[model samples]
Target: MTIAALQTVPQQIETAAIAQVRPKILMVDDRWENLLATEKVLKPLKADIFKAASGNEALSLVLRHRFAIVLLDVQMPEMDGFETATLMQEHESMTGVPIIFVTALSKEEKYASRAAEIGAVDYIFKPINPDILKSKVKVYLDLYVQREQIMRLNATLSQSNEELERFAYICSHDMQEPVRMMNAFAGLLAENAEEAIDEDGRRYLSFILDNARRMQKMINDILTFSRVGREEILLEPVDCEAILRETLSEFEGVIQDSGAEVTYTPLPCVETSSTLVRVLFQNLIGNALKFQNGSQPPLIAVMAEKQGRYWRFSVKDNGIGIENGFRGRIFTIFQRLHRKEDYPGTGIGLSTCRKFIRLCGGEIDFTSAPGQGSTFHFTLPSGEAARPTRSGQQAC
Candidate 1:
């Protein structure tokens, strides 16, 4: 019979017997007799044996194949066991391979300390007891396999989290744009309606416009929050004063018409995204102006102070203050405390502000009592002064 045919016949016959074979073992020693003795001791376990005459050869074998246990002799010439262990740790695949020192030397304090320092998994003295060696090797091999499996599971979970975040961003962005267009057109239709339109028809049109706008705003806010979690941010020193001035300029017309008086202490410069900080301030100031009591001019004040690593900023408004119970719900999308006729908004401005603050590694909080004034507080990294303010304010 051909040699290949002969090998196949024996392999098929032994398949059932070999199913319970012990894990593979690699032996590295300068002495041929020690290698033979180790093989003989482990023979009863029916494990695959790999032999290396020197430390370098052992490392080479480890690179080419995986072993459950490595029996390394510490007294080998040239590249000693400790050096081999260090080199093994530097290899990505071999770093977790368990090393057991099998030597004839006595277990002295210094040797034990050095073994641990060199990352030996355990030390075994020569004239070894076969039973103890076999049991210890088996325990370590099982542990190594379990640890590798856990690492693989963690890697899989991390990948899944990243994919989910990406999907959320994509879905939110794709859905919100069309919703915004629908709301805009609905508003136009309501504004252009003729006198012949019935009261019920007008009411329905108003409901459609209002609810559609609310839904669109919620989707937009969700998209902003999701993007903050998924996108990498570029942080730099930002001029708070400049951003605030720009935001105020955008609201000049409303401020003029409302007879709102805005005063500010010099704001400290800080490290943040100027665009995001501007959004935060705009929302706070805009809310103050929009919610003023009837026929009363609004008084708004802005201030900042340095506190440890952060700048604490406050925007205080003498407007129709929030109720205590509704303060907590203010930063939630679509959570309006007032009716559409009482106040007009998408109910997303505060929530968007909170999201932007969190993205900049900051926090926003506020306190209010019904019929009293309210103050919104936030913080940003203290690094620089705010951008220069405009010399004077103009009416809206």
Candidate 2:
């Protein structure tokens, strides 16, 4: 009767239908009687059993269908079970397929060890026990079913995420044109008919233009956020120092005008997406410069230290820090701690930083005290070999 239970009814029915479809199991034996006897034993499990008289036939059948498990015989004509299992493992699609070797050979520890070395999940002696065989086969069958369900769920979730991103991109793209028109027309009215319009009308037009501009910015930010991990990103060796210098160059005017002092140590060369890391640094450094106390100029320090397989980078500033209450909302999209008049931002910078950091296999967080300043820290996966140079300091 509850809403949550009601919503799951359809999914439960669909799962029951999926469960009704029999799982495929392959049995490889030189003897038809053995295969037939095993098939009879597994009948209660309701599996679609396929018999292979040779290893070659088993390999061929494996290529054609996705099997739940393969029961292989040790002694075959040309190719035996060990060789067959090794060959099957070489194929990309047959990598995780559980192979159980059924042999009538001597009960030596070496044979079992050899079977294990060749990727056999279990070794069963000749004259298979009906109950034991059924139990072992059922365990693998249940595992295969669970794995299939997980794969389907992951695929469905991925498709849903792609659709949501596409929706956000399209919605934001369509909204830009109307906002552009509003801003342009309002600007033109204020410029061309300033004398004809009253003071109140001019003020109203200004408000419209300002709001339109803000809306346009918000739309653009949304588009950028949606596109963060949408496409395939190639990882290459990117010099972190070079990325920082380029980001700072873009904010040259702001740094000069604010009289903010910036310094950084030599950064390591990490293997990651250049574009994403640059966005992260740009946002963090830009925020450091933007949020400042009126009494003193901003002092920003960018430093990096190697921690295990990650490079922990910190951006510390001597600007107005975040209050304890607003810390939780600081990294949320469109969540601002201050009024628009105080700090002119769409509140997407830190969120974008978080997104980009996560996309590059990292995390972002900050330590702040109100009126003292904040230090934003993030980690990046160091490449297989992070080429770090001599550490020295540079001021700008």
Candidate 3:
């Protein structure tokens, strides 16, 4: 078939096909002739073509419609194609829109390089070839349609995640209130028994109260974990050394009683969510002190170092340490090797720490062997590193 005939056939099919499929395109150029030329070149494609005579008008059309592809002219006055493409990228919905430059310039290396740098998908010279343009636009339009479908799927998935998080927060909050009430009334009954209850009855009541309190703590941790992703984290410079010192002071009584020797080199400033980082260090250090064995004083060390793209922090404790087999299981919620009477924890500390690290765009892991020592390691984005805020200062 001839080029004109070939182009005309698709236009006829597209007019009918586009009635059901509302695929759109934005055509941008300074010259009216260039704009008409692009429209003619893309006539065969099954799309709704919108025209704009300037970069500003192109941007307005982009804001109003989600175009499958943008045919842009490079040498427009005021805001050129590069500037227009950059502006389009700033919009979340337009970030992935395919941009093709239709310019009169020859195949020069500088212009070609600049086009790629500004994220143009293809470059077409003036005196357009209808057949070639038809094929090129067809390829990009098909890809754009596929991308739109993927975006729709992602939107659905994101909505589902939000719903799940809300459900967890509500369920955990509602469950804990009644559990606290049960513990309170159980304590009152134990204190004021009409006729002194038997030793067995007293033991059962104590167990009920203790378990209820533990459940309450777990529920609170679960709620915190669920909300971390939903809440907006205020990023700021945070002094790691100061936060650690304050956390140590909060556990002063425990440190003194256990005779734990805690030492740390100076920590550098890092950009992060201060509250979350404090909770992170508190849990790690507290675990170190809590798990000591054989009455040997716990020797804890906290250190930080710059790794590529992230800062790696380590908390090393010369305490009981974990077995190699159970190392992976320790970070999971309610997955404890020791009984409640022995460890005295609800087994939610490490799980909460993991959640906090993830919220800060980081990861937490560990290495341990029985009776040696355990070192918990975590990484935070280094680009976000900054001087830490003062102690007790709220993050903004």
Candidate 4:
């Protein structure tokens, strides 16, 4: 036999086992006879059928187990189909559970519309059309199977991601010690043994110390990036305008040293982590000041415009713009376009911006041409959830 044929037996057995544990379907009616008829009609599907003689019993059964589809009767004691469906619609768990009303009611347009308003998926008459009933129920069953598969895959992927993040944290933490020692001893060598070394030897020692310092910064950034996601982030209404001003004040020395003229328009508050939002502005503004062409003072402007469900923010700078060829890797970790001698950086700033933007459920993009300056744009959750301000006063 061929190798493919040889492997068919075990595969078939596994498929059969999964199919054997059939999807659950709830059949609800005051009449025991009606419930039995549904079970008999649906027997070909080989599903795990649960019968309830009253609406109350059906609700009780639903609370205990998850059903792929619910076959409900319109006429019942204590509670009716509409009431039960309304209750199901309100429930957190049973909200997505499809319900098909097995009613003997007239086929008037209003009757169907009423059921729809109450969230009924479909309706069937007194004379159960076995073919139609099975067909409708089959769609929900297939959907349920697909949903189960997706949930399982998501769970597996989540576990793998958690493990990867843990590994990153451990590696970054372990690396800090060695980098610190190299930096400290290199400093000591430069200070105490400089008289005995030649000029080139001293130069080599300087390079070692500089690189060691850079490595230390990069390691600390990596640890922050890895650990931030694990930290408890309390999200709320954050005033974007206020955050920008506060960050600017903190970087007052850098701004004055660079002779940069920073200006911004009214910025709306957004729903996000206040701490991370400040970090994002700090990095973006810092990059603008750091990447100058040395001929003119930096002119940076920040603006926000609403775009549907998000606010599209732009940080425009008149400094050295990114070349089109290297733009693709701009957000990559530790990727720098300039040499360390010309531009001193660990290349972790923009990458951190990309990370925080995603964590807050948004995306980032930029437009730049070499030496013509660049405008970086990113989207964040709009200020719909922001705290209310006065009639004319801006919310920071």
Best by TM-score: 2
State which candidate has the highest lDDT. 2
Q: What lDDT would candidate 3 get against the real structure?
A: 0.81
Q: Least lDDT summed over 10 consecutive residues: which range in candidate 1?
A: 387-396
Ordered list by lDDT, greatest first: 2, 4, 3, 1
The lDDT of each candidate is 0.77, 0.85, 0.81, 0.82
Worst 10 residues of 2 by lDDT: 387-396
Clashes of 4: 0
**Candidate 2 local lDDT, 131-224, one digit each (tens):** 9999999999888887777766666556555666687788899899999999999999988999999989989988998899999988988898
lDDT of 4 by residue, 1-396 (tens): 334643454554445435433589999899998888889988888579999988778778878888888899988889998888787666566868899987888888887898888778897788888898889999889888778766655665565546656776788799999999999999999999999999999999999998999889888888877766687777888888899999899879988987889999888888888877787888888888889988999999999887788888999999899988987689988799999788888788788778877887888889998889999999987755765467432363
Q: In terms of TM-score, which candidate is stronger, 1 or 2?
A: 2
Candidate 1 per-residue lDDT, tens place, 226-285, comes to 566566766677767677788889899999998889988776567677767877888888
Return the clash pairs for model 3, or none.
237-387, 237-388, 238-387, 238-388, 239-388, 270-386, 271-385, 271-386
Q: Output the TM-score of candidate 3.
A: 0.60
Clashing pairs in 4: none
